[model samples]
Target chain A: MIKDIMLISELGELALIEKIRGYFSIGDSGVLIAIGDDAAVFSADKKNIVTTSDLMSEGVHFDYTYTTFYQVGFRLVISNVSDIYAMGAVPSYLFLNMALTGKRSEEEFDDFLKGVREACEHYNAKVLGGDLSLSIKGDFYSATLIGFADRVKTRSGAKPGHNIFITGNTGDSAAGLAYLKYVKKRIPMEKNMEYTSREIDGTILDTVRRHLIPCACNPETFIDKIKAMIDISDGLLLDLYRICAESRAGALIYRDNIPVSDGVRAIASMLEMDYMDFVLSGGEDYELIITSDSDHLDDCILIGKIIKDGFFFVDSDGIREKFVPKGYTHF
Target chain B: MIKDIMLISELGELALIEKIRGYFSIGDSGVLIAIGDDAAVFSADKKNIVTTSDLMSEGVHFDYTYTTFYQVGFRLVISNVSDIYAMGAVPSYLFLNMALTGKRSEEEFDDFLKGVREACEHYNAKVLGGDLSLSIKGDFYSATLIGFADRVKTRSGAKPGHNIFITGNTGDSAAGLAYLKYVKKRIPMEKNMEYTSREIDGTILDTVRRHLIPCACNPETFIDKIKAMIDISDGLLLDLYRICAESRAGALIYRDNIPVSDGVRAIASMLEMDYMDFVLSGGEDYELIITSDSDHLDDCILIGKIIKDGFFFVDSDGIREKFVPKGYTHF
Candidate 1:
């Protein structure tokens, strides 16, 4: 018979770890040292090595009330793998560090680990090892994934006159967040209206999906010939600025040519916020903002041309102007 | 004049990453791609690589109230490097993921970073890159260190009859903790006094030092010659079990030969606790426990000998006997 009880201070950290160790079994090969050490040792080869990390805090990065503990676990895995994909690499293994809240329910922990196991199967990355600890007062989570990359591409390779392109429409997450705020405000609105609370349901769901399960570019099949690339994390405009800065070139993006989804534009209009601000400053829509030479424009869509000066913008009036170099800031 | 306060929720994840892009000023030589991408790209010549990681949570691992933030930062860096040292590798670089309370006083943040910077310099490991996130509530910290190994050693590499040894005495941390607890209980204590709480003062301070800055052996200098190795993290007896289990060997530890500091002993005596329990099961000592057939007892005091069987024990009665396997556990 099993007894259900609470009171972690009685067991302490060492006993707690021992209790949890039974659940994890080591995989054969590649892992030299798995657990019970200061760190996990892995057998790595030169042909492929990938590493990325993400931090998810409680109130800042997640809310236990709104987001189920399971969704948080799934997104944590994807965030790391998404980095591997951005490197034009395949996902392989992961190492997680979980800082748990004292009041966390056992069911919540079970669901959280289940979410991790599911993501591992989805991406084929092995959950090699991790460290688990209890927080003092509040809860937090972080993860680092090590992947495999053969030939890698970087953001510093963008050149002047190179065509800049992106994978999908921008402003999804930004608009969805605005919609959430509007709904929370209890503002009266029509049912089934496009930008209203109900009509925006599907778009918000899709945005949430995109925000959570970050879609990675198929790096294995396409990374070899790529010149300069970046994940569209910061808005397209800001990401372009980074690519240009590192590559020692400037870019002039045509405002009309930028991809802004219908739902995104409608939300921006409803909120009386500039569509361009969502397109320029809004973040978390993980897409690829890539650049290739002018000759390769047919190979990729031409959003703008990289110039020698710095970040530039071309409006619908055909007037070219300079733009500030600001992206997302946590501090 | 810093009028705009950036809430992580307002910017989301991508824009937050973009906001920090300007801070990455130095060009990484091995980097094929840095920030603003899915994963940072790194290139290297075909060679065996050593990688390790560790996580430090707020309450479980440390107390910010008594422990200076700088010491906590320094200790985190020290802990990861010690693992690399245990493998006989020269640490090359590090990647840090620090989750801040975000509402930290500037003084606190600066002190913490200073600790990190100083530790990096001490270990000769460059801080190549890092991620800073606003945590939910507690301060969360984790680090991954990459090192180059000339001759990597595994715990399973031990052969039958190899001598087992450790670098230094153990259980200092437990002694320190006991002392800290006694002091916290408002027990009046004097340094060098025979009282359990009294003997704890000096012993606790010394043990606390051992807990923070462990003696790290330059593993690269000796790992090639060593047959099997593991850090004495969980305890000497437990770690010996791991080496024997992996190497398909057995070990007989000479309990009388095990090293114990006077301070550790004093604390144990005062607490009316078994000295062997503190030495046998105490975790986080971070000293290297090695096994080699070459008979290098002078280099490190020999504590045991490998046998052909599965497991054996040297008891308080000075008789050797068979027993169940033991070690520290991490969930």
Candidate 2:
């Protein structure tokens, strides 16, 4: 008997995305700004503008299976806003694109809008306008955010001797993911814990909160002295390396001084994983990592710069040199 | 027995996009712009800024599917330019975001850049900065276009006493789709025909071409007397009603006077569908449907008219009646 083979839908969105990527040819100027950063960049002067977009698939990016309507809405806005903040720009407006499936209750739509509205207000941005469509499958969401700045900080701006400073702690989202996965493993006892999640030590509960509601700094706050800037999305090591590559530089650091939350540490210990690796390589941190002039060391101290580029870790008078370059890579 | 559920990647790009649209809340903003329209519109000041976004999913929006890398690059730029034209705005600049699947070849990336460069030159617009990302699933493409204008031509601007005008003939893209589908069916046997396609007497072929590559007029050219405007995306009749709703107006279109290509008439007739209906409800027509100050009828002659409220259409006998609102709906 002869049989015919069929392509199954089980290939996964990631795999399908891989197949699609093959067609694109990146021109020298093809990207002015390419993909895989906090936001896409092009060249627009007058007032330098930064733009970013993200698409959240119903089942892939989110799971109504585990995510609440409100959580979904919050994450959607946070993800995009984080990009603008990453670029060291104040997010001003967002355009949303959505597709719906089956019959959605008016309440669900209302909650969704409320989520968007609240995020806008919180970040001092506005929901300018967007496009909407209906789908035969599950719901999908895409958002484009526009932010303005006089200068933009790219991943490739760190100098060889510049100190790297992050606005907040990292690896909370990864820890949160672990917690969520653990909770899912013990089902039949579902509790809406995201909104007012309890304090957990060494497990990044707070860092996760920071991830959920990352802060946005007005670029105007420190207009000068910010030699280079980038958002810490793809882990500090990776994103910083990008800055290094773009700027053609290298870095040095003290692992002892790297910030880590109690919850993240606890979680890492429980999972038997290296906590430093999480802090070093975890993506979605969403903090601003900046390099400034040495004369502007005041700015670094004001913004919390802990590690210097030519630093040696001293343990009981035994000084040893070390270099850290841990960042996220999609491939 | 356990039944496994479906995943998004298994669904492909089109299915994923449908899912994204499903999650958006369009609110009461009249027209629903979805999968087909070159751009989407919402209620805003006719004299203010018009906003639209075109998101290119790395794998879905652009595939290695029967398209050139440069074509993909050019089309991405062209797609947004068309949207600004659709809204009757002089497109000025663009904000782009892209997500890559992997390390792009330097030469290929350069070619992609050339495509964008050529497009920018053709459109007379500047490339604004945007975000870049590495897609966990695939490469992602997105752009937000900002345009300035005096009056935004909406689909809801037509009134009863107004005459309907179409900028050009319809059904080119529809015809294109048919030819492609037919050719695909005859492949392996009549493969030679693929390289050379002739114009058909009456096929949706013309309509399909119109769909694929639309001609646009500079909205700024007629800014003064143009009271309302909407790019013909979802057929004439449906788009007309949207104009009517917005302007609190109606329209009187001469059914026989409506434009239809010979190719469209031929194929539509074989399908036993009314050519007028195809002209009326068949969409992807990028012509401008506008209403104007009847005093400027000479200028407005380029397309349709401005009528009094209520009497949207009139017959040769001078009898007027209501026309059912039937354009395109995503939901």
Report the lDDT tens digits of candidate 1 across residue range A1-331.
Answer: 8655443333433343343233223434344333332123343554645567677887766555545666677767776766667666677656666766545655566557666666766787655444555566666677777666565566678777677776677777666656655655322221122333454455455554454444554545445556777666556776777677667788888767778776677677878888777777777676677776534432344567777876677888989887886655554
The model with the greatest DockQ is 2
Q: Give the worst 10-residue stretch by lDDT in candidate 2 chain B.
A: B185-194
Question: How many clashing pairs does model 2 include?
Answer: 107
lDDT of 1 by residue, B1-331 (tens): 7555443334432333233343222243343333321112233465534556677887677775556677777778777777677656677566677776545655566566667767777777755444566665678888777776655566677887788878778787666666555555322222222435344365565665665444455555445557887776566677677777767888888777788887788878878888777787777777778887766744577788888986666866878777665444432
* lDDT per residue (tens digit) for residues B106-180 in model 2: 444445555555666667665554544443344445567766545455555454555455566755544444444
For each candidate, what TM-score against the reference?
Answer: 0.74, 0.74
Candidate 2 reaches a DockQ of: 0.16
* Residue B316 lDDT (model 2): 58
lDDT of each: 0.63, 0.56
Counting clashing residue pairs in each candidate, in order, gives 9, 107
